[model samples]
Target: MLAWAGCLGYAAYYSGLDAVAGISAGAVAGNGVHGAVGWLFSTGDELGRAGVYALTLAALSAGSVLLRRHGVRELPGAVVVLGACWLFLDSHIFWPRGVFTMLAFAVGFGLLTVAASRWSGRLTNP
Candidate 1:
């Protein structure tokens, strides 16, 4: 999921759409055909593509942390997915442009995921 979003955003950015691809990036984080349409329309023109690289960075970084927290441990799907994104997906945007963004997103989402994991609400505690 995160790899798909990252690759899609990277490709969109390279196509000269600037950051407007973020719309599709956020949209693709979920499921369904709406994301496909959003990716197509957003990348096709100049509208709704702002902050795309940042979106990719956030999704990938946060998703990696979350994957680590989960049980994808046998093969380390996070590393595998990230590596595949860089190798096959051509994630130059992440190396040269979005490294800092990825770091920031990683820290932010890591904390959030931890806090959420520790949370014990009325319903959850029961």
Candidate 2:
């Protein structure tokens, strides 16, 4: 329960950061600074957005360590939240195509569940 809560909390925090970054980028772009909006969303891809990604990674690492102390491996917990975020973003932001998007989200959710389960199992046997 703690693991799930922590992961979800981190996911929400990350999303909030992303939202602020997006708004900042838009404001910058609106001020005639073209090519800057995309940089904020680059995350770890480029040096320009390194600070945001670094902060996010640091938060996740700290959260993972805390979760581990509670007898839960971080991978499954992290995967569950991150995977859901990915599915939500991909379907809504990247491709909002109707039934196909719904199907893709369903499939992705199933896959994420399987992956999280397998990852969680390693904590017991390994």
Best lDDT goes to which candidate?
2
Q: Write the per-residue lDDT of candidate 2 for residues 10-59, one digit (tens) a residue.
A: 45655654565567777887899878766665641233233334433543
lDDT of 1 by residue, 39-67 (tens): 65546344313335534464566566565
Collision count for each candidate, in order: 6, 0
Candidates' C-alpha lDDT: 0.48, 0.50
Off by over 4 Å in 2: 44-86, 92-126
Which residue pairs come into collision in candidate 1?
Answer: 19-49, 19-50, 19-51, 20-49, 20-50, 21-49
TM-score of 2: 0.35
Backbone steric clashes in candidate 1, count: 6
The reply for model 1, stretches above 4 Å from the true place, is 1-92, 121-126
In lDDT terms, how accurate is model 1? 0.48
